[model samples]
Target: MTGATQRVADALRDAIEAGTYPPGGALPSSEDLAKAHGVAKVTAQKAVNQLAAEGYLTVVRRQPARVAEGPRRLSVVRDRKVYRDQIGYYFDQNAKPWGAIGTPTRGVATPPAHIADLLGTPRGRDVMTRTRLMAPKGSKVAHQVAISYIPVPVVAEVPAVGSSNTGPGGIYDRFEEHYGGPLEWRETVSARQSTSEEQTQLQIPANSSVLVVTREARIASGRTAVVVEVNETTMSAARFAVSYPIERDSSAGWSSTGGPRD
Candidate 1:
């Protein structure tokens, strides 16, 4: 990718992050973006393709591209013991919401095979899904793009979904409120790739790197609640942090007196 591509990617990332292109909002066409950026249509198309591959944008057949919805504002502190379960496990008591806004986008078919496995159901099971672009607070750029899937049954209970624009508070909170229990456990796996759709959403240059994070969450009763899949181009400059605690030994050969040992 040329510097122009990077420039385009950065510009688009900012737009998504800042709510310029709200979730489910359509992005300008390649020709329009090219004219806006003073670049060739090919360059604009390339940049858009990169964003789409990274999960920032989705391209529908014969339809214009759109911005994906991202995570609601939630923060996780490193190394804190928040909760315990059957096994001794430490959990974060407080989660700071990342500034990513959640706008309901047009529902799409589930593509990845792993998502079906997480749902413990068939790939074509009428699952409810949404996509978002994530822009953390105090940041000028949008770093990550995410898609979430839940059983249709789960979403039908909320009734507020598929309509209205909800800010940083994501579906997880809504599910807990309506269903009566918080998400107790989550598992995540990450990788790197460039999908056709991500290139458009992230506006990544050709050959630029991207990251994918797949996560699953469940309630204390062992029922699957949500599956989140994220794709982010390196240009978005998104970062994630994790923390844990270690025990300290206070009795390690420290003498009460300041005298040297004989």
Candidate 2:
């Protein structure tokens, strides 16, 4: 949090993000950093220490700090098939970093303005909302956050979704069983500096950035089903990769349609 240290940390972080220091490569020591940045040793050390605390570096006694390996890559297939899988499978598999989603806080409440727009509901309209904080499984720092919003009508049809535990296959499965509707999904990815709250929740340092994935799930009938927001600190971006198997065209240059035979 120190100003001088943060400046130095920012420079080194840029270098790391730019791939100047490959994973597992050693970073300059505090003495070297101090000389390079014209700052005191303690200031340089804090810079390295802060990066380590933020999941960017590892500090071991008697050795220079080393760039840490990225967290497990979270790959989500962009298919519309019943997405009944719980998020635990994505972040908690092997339980290395995120072992389980902590107890969720859920209720009927008013969603944010943008989310309301996405849900096709009036602002301040009450809807079923669920918030979760993932639990760290090992020494890994907690770095992701998820929040979901669904219209009351849908929750009324599938009451289980209003509960903290949506049970096996999750809410989508419940929707399929109770509402008998096929769902479609779309996601938008963006990046920006982390907010103060995100910094605390994700344990990232000041000036750190995060990946914001705004997702919309709709029924085949063209009704907006639900909207979910997924957040991951930029420091963890190295560990995650997003792959969309887009189709190519002979004359059109690209195909806009998603489904088979479209």
Candidate 3:
């Protein structure tokens, strides 16, 4: 990521963008790349690694790094609205294009610290987790990994959420149906370097970036909101982009900061 390494990476990226190396095409070896870029072999290798992490190239041991098949970038759009089917499948528009790689894997286990906190699970206690790996339908690349963690308290009330089959609408629908009505959702987004597992599943290289979306399912109480489930979604940052609408409001404009609302 230094000036020299980044300069080399930028040149290669420019070439890739320009079709100098078409998809699934092979790039020159590190030594050749170094000679072309007038950088050290190590610098060239770093550049290759850089582009690989950015989801451009695929690296293999003792082989030339090649362009990954498919468009260099995948634009994954995130929709804010949640939808439900009449038959009970609760989902969002963002998921319409993708399907699960397999049936959701479920288990009761101690969740990570952050997940535990989000689910309000007590330390040393376990939670029910339903995990699914989703990808664009018919695409070879994985799009995201979603894990939904439910507090034991909620699981106890609605045992279906703890099981592989949640009847019809899935966990969200079951939750709302059992709790009486609609459920509220809140999301917090952040970014981090891809984990080893994520890099393998997402087909990115080490140090690749991933976007993390942590969503909370809530129910309204008489005077407060209670969280029942936490869903964490991890997507390759190089391949996915979150989209949302911005509403125009004078009360939220810079004018509000300059003076009282007009």
Candidate 4:
């Protein structure tokens, strides 16, 4: 992915990042780029294709490739505060704050082995599931995908959560209200190549990667009540900034400092 093709693509990417071609704005045609850069037309097309695969551009039929919209930057900070009438933090920050959520698909499904383990349930157990595909208010493309799972027992206690119309503040609010006590949450983040299913749901190029976040919610009774997995096409690596508070203790050497405690 280097040499002439990459050089040209890098130049165009830089221009796009600098806002020379904003989202929904078209870049120069391959013919124009070939003539301007003294390269073959095929080389120019390859460069454009590379940009598209990298999530920087998209093709328009009967027209030149257009600059793709950048991903919304989300800050992941260390905090355990729960607000009344608030949707889960990630949903609130990335989706609900900007627009209404598309109707979520609600039902019960068998949990995957890994999810079952996290929820402390036997494999193949049926669990309450809520899946959502969300786009910002005026955007045409969905930018976020989330699937939340609640053990069958937890669902029995808070039946309202099983419905798509879990009302304002969402399921977390219902948990606090019906389950008796404030809720606590912790999140673990990881990334990998997007699977075919993820590609289809996110409408991203096959070459693009995705960020996977695992969120766990615990009730006052100290039971892990919910586990949610969120997937999104990776934005430009340079775009996201993350911060976590560190507790300092002289008694423990720097090497001995444990991970953040929720």
Q: Which candidate has the highest lDDT of all?
A: 3
Local accuracy by lDDT, each model: 0.58, 0.64, 0.78, 0.65
**What are the candidates' C-alpha RMSDs?**
13.7, 10.2, 10.8, 10.8
What is the TM-score (0 to 1) of candidate 3?
0.66
TM-score of each: 0.48, 0.56, 0.66, 0.58
Q: Order the candidate numbers by lDDT, best to worst.
A: 3, 4, 2, 1
Judge candidate 4 at residue 183 and give its lDDT. 64
Error of 2 at 31 (Å): 15
Q: Which one wins by TM-score: 2 or 4?
A: 4
List candidate 2 segments past 4 Å from native.
1-63, 66-98, 135-140, 220-246, 250-262
Question: What are the per-residue Cα lDDT tens digits for candidate 1 across 1-262?
Answer: 8989878877886676545686788998888999999999989988888778777888787777898765132233434233543332333334233444445364746646667777665776666667766555544444566666666655566755444553334455565665577655444534455566666666554443454545565654346444322221122323233334565455444455974333
* Per-residue lDDT of candidate 2, residues 59-107 (tens digit): 9999999998772345534433322233422322323345434566776
In angstroms, give how far residue 230 of model 3 lies from its true place. Answer: 0.5
Count of backbone collisions within predicted model 2:
0
- Which runs of model 3 end up more than 4 angstroms from their true locations? 1-72, 86-94, 221-224, 250-262
Per-residue lDDT tens digits for candidate 3, residues 1-262, read 7788988897787566444686799999999999988889999999999999988999999988999885455544555666666655444565666778867798887887888887777876888888888876654456788888888888888888887778777887778778776788878889999889887676666787899989889886556777889998998776567777777566765564686555
Clashing pairs in 2: none
